[model samples]
Target: MASGSPLQPTLGELIASLSLQLTTLVKGEVELAKAQVAEKGKSMGLGIGLFVGAGLFGFFAFAVLIATAVLGIATALPAWLSALIVGVALLLFAGLLAFVGKKSLDKAKEVKPEPVANLKQDIEIVKDGFTS
Candidate 1:
């Protein structure tokens, strides 16, 4: 038989060849996973950048709307007084939101997760069993 004949590989040679193929397959899979993750990360970054741009535009639009309201009110009241009224109203709304948020946070602080409570009870039962 020829030295290079496929039908005559030694056991050691066959094992070596299998190991090389497995190594190559694993390396290829790792490379593919890295490439997929990189593509997803790029897409996520772009999406986040677009969201930030949208938020900035929304903020400008809100400022413009507030300006329009001030200008509309200026038709009846002095410009300074109208601006002050709008500012005070905005502060009051912000304060109300802060109060509600604080209350919600306080309520959240009072609550405990069931799993944590169960775990603590289980630990105490184990301790009691050991003591008894």
Candidate 2:
């Protein structure tokens, strides 16, 4: 039974079928990548939210500890002056942390320019093909 006798595909038809399958495979891969990226973004958002909540609770706990320390020291000094001293110290510490945090955030903002450069190089390579 030669191809096209109602049994097998002809060579042209086989090529056309292969092309269609390749297109479908590429489309399916692109869709899978999109779904994975979406899921990762959702997980990252939830993780960031939990981190923020934990940081807030940690700050509250620190405040309570500061208050306790101030109250403990009040027996040796006047309560109001003790509180004022502790508050000033805390303010100075907070300012230092803010300064360091600002520097850290600035560094974070500039993280990994190399990845972008590499992506651009990859685009150029793809555009130029294997010649150079």
Candidate 3:
């Protein structure tokens, strides 16, 4: 068994193997990137949705306030008094929005792209095996 023919590889076979392995590696990377991008896209979409919801709600509130002023129920009060009360309420509402926006940003910032990280790790393991 000591003497044997050389362990030779034909060009076609070698190219084929390399091509297959390259394709696999590329596919794995694409999968990982897709997972990460998908997660980020999902978060982006959610953020946009939240902003849209807030805008709609704010529009409704604004209309309601305008309606209240138009209804003339506050006419019993002095004009200056009514204006002062509305100003205070607006200030309070603005402060509440600031507080809420800060909290929402904090929560959203905490969202990690776990799907991407896990997929990347998996891809790395396989890639390493192939390279090694």
Candidate 4:
């Protein structure tokens, strides 16, 4: 056989080169995936943090509005009495909401799907067929 030239590779060398290249490609792809996930995670974290900040500001704004309502009422009544009236009204509204929420939950719990009954009947029929 003629001597192999510099440009010619044996079968084993070609396989080894292919394996090395594939491994490098896979590693590069994994690194790229990791970096992409990290960037998305940072973006999601920032968005959630901004939402929380907005919620905090909204809460403060709502409190200010409530205070303004109390001040308005105080002009016509004693400050303490006006505040107490507003507090009681808020409590009553909360209680009404709680009662309605509980009723909705109870209704949801009471729902029995027809599919479940049909499934149970199917299971019983299968069992009876097996016994026969």
Q: Estimate each model's TM-score.
A: 0.80, 0.66, 0.42, 0.74
Stretches > 4 Å off in candidate 3: 1-13, 71-132
Tens-place lDDT digits, model 1, residues 1-132: 336567788778999999999999999999999999999999999999999999999999999998998999999999999999999999999999999999999999999779988999999999999999
- Which 10-residue span in candidate 4 carries the lowest summed lDDT? 1-10
How do the residues 24-115 of candidate 2 rate in per-residue lDDT, one tens digit apiece?
A: 99999999999999999999999999999999999999889999989988989999999999989989999999999999999999885788
How well is each residue in 81-120 modelled by candidate 3, as lDDT tens digits? 7767777877899999999999999999999779988999
As for TM-score, the candidate ahead, 2 or 4, is: 4
| CA lDDT, every model vs. true structure | 0.95, 0.93, 0.86, 0.94
Question: Of 2 and 4, which scores higher on lDDT?
Answer: 4
Models sorted by lDDT, best on top: 1, 4, 2, 3
Worst ten-residue run, lDDT, model 2?
1-10
**Residue lDDT tens for model 4, 46-111:** 999999999999999988988988899999999998899888988999999999999999999899
By TM-score, the candidates rank as 1, 4, 2, 3
RMSD of candidate 2 to the truth, in angstroms, is 7.7
lDDT of 3: 0.86
